[model samples]
Target: MIEDWRQRRAAKRITSGDGRALKRLRWWQLPFRALFYLTLPNGDGRQTEYAVDIPRRIDSEGGKARAHLYLDGRHHAESKLPAAFPVEGGTIEMAISAFGLKRCHYVTTAGAQHRLIPDPRSAEGRRARVEREHPTLSRSISHLSALILLVGVGLNLLQLAEPMSRIPPIAESIGTFESPVRLPIWLNFALAVGAVLGSAERALRLRYGVLDRAGK
Candidate 1:
């Protein structure tokens, strides 16, 4: 029921495009832009190519991130972040994170989901290549990213608990609490940086979780 509501809400946000040609992904735009493609067969026995283009740093319509949908290279439709653009056989759903895209996929009418193929020159494509060529190393890096986020979440909760426990109402019930592990300011700063990098790395592979999303 909640998913259906979300889809309906997203559907309302889409707007028709002006039919401009989709811009080519430039070398310098790779780090800040994401482009993905999907090909689907039509009832006429022909294939249609759809592309999703996103400029991660750019905002539109009052500071909201936007995504563009292209049909065989021409702009077809657009919507704000967390969008759902209805397509030939399904909907192209997209959402962004502070560091990059958290989600970009095609959800079919029958409920099967497929991630779109990233443009070869983009950061996501590079990460996908690494996974294809070095599965073991890719797995190790993914694991490490998760571990970093977990540690970040744990430390954050511990620090937060100390402050919350100091509140008058809480102190009366639980007494003032002290964090068992307190690191130096420099170490905390380093950990914060690590968390951002870890979250970005996970974003490159389209992996997102609540804890990692907070770090981002």
Candidate 2:
């Protein structure tokens, strides 16, 4: 019931795109741009290309950032973040997080979901290339990212618990609690930086989870 309501709200947020030619991705824009593509059948045995473009570093002064949809290389429609754009078979869902995109996929009428392919020159594209060319190494890196996020989140929770336990109401009821793990300020800052990079790496692969989201 709640999902349905959220879907309707997202649908309402969409606005028609002005007719403009989609720009090509440039080298300098690789870090701040995300472009994904989907090729779907056009009923006549031909394929139609749809692209979703988002400039992560750019934002509107008064509203949420928008995701632009291009059909066959021309602007079609656009919507705010966490967009759900209706297409041939289903909806193209797009979402973003602090580090990068957390979701960009197509959900079919049959309930199956498929991720859109990133542009070959983009950062995400380079990451995807690495995965294809070096499967074992890619798997290892992915595991390391998860481990980093886990440690970061665990430390954060412990740090929070110590302060919360010191509150008068909680301390009176359950006694004072001390955190077992504590690090110097500089080391903590370093770990926080590592956590952000780890989350960004996962974002390049379109991976998201509770720990990944929390680390961001």
Candidate 3:
């Protein structure tokens, strides 16, 4: 069984074209090449260091993608890793910086190395999933607020409210605001859309990186 499993995993290869896996496929692809910078309080005034980069995505199972770690352009010795390496669940963390928006993770195990989705949604980020779920009340509120914002924006655009019908005041307000510029037509529409988007974001618990039900 073990040999069969190994053969199956090896067949998929450590990597594919660029993004490796579909989740990773982005406009910008980092080669086996991102560098991580770390400083230790060892304050020998010397910077403690290791080569860290984004984890590799490989097939852990038939056609299933997982992440694995590398260090210093090569994998590093966890044993010798200067006590300074970030540790979590017996695994160290690495981040690829060139792509400001991307994240990476890996684990070293007696069994095969494991890979994971790059963001808060990953199983490692279970807490994030909890936050996204938050509580029913909060989710409801975000949805309701979004709806109200949309309605308000609509009212502004339709000139349905007498006060909003005056363009001069609104134009002046728009010019003065640090927030979104208030255009009677498109601007209001955008705000309404934003309301929905914002609510959706909260609903997804991407806001605080946590999605959990209340009283859970």
Clashes of each: 0, 0, 15
Ranking by lDDT: 2, 1, 3
Candidate 1 stretches greater than 4 Å from native: none
CA error at residue 85 for candidate 1, angstroms: 0.8
Models sorted by TM-score, best on top: 2, 1, 3
lDDT of 1 by residue, 100-121 (tens): 8889999999999999999988
Residues 58-125, model 3: lDDT tens digits:
23444322333333223443211111133332334332211121333334444433333323423223
Q: What is the TM-score of each candidate against the true structure?
A: 0.94, 0.95, 0.23
The residue-by-residue lDDT of candidate 2 on 17-132, one tens digit each, is: 88899899998998889999999998999999999998885455636778999999999998889899999999999998888999999999888999999999889999999999
Q: Cα deviation of 80 in candidate 2 (Å)?
A: 0.6
**Residue 43 miss distance in model 2 (angstroms):** 0.9
Deviation in Å, model 2, residue 125 alpha carbon = 0.9
Note the residue pairs that clash in candidate 2. Answer: none
- Count of backbone collisions within predicted model 3: 15
lDDT minimum window of 10 residues, candidate 3: 207-216
The stretch of ten residues in a row with the least summed lDDT in candidate 2 is 57-66
Once fitted onto the true fold, the runs of candidate 2 whose alpha carbons sit more than 4 angstroms away are none
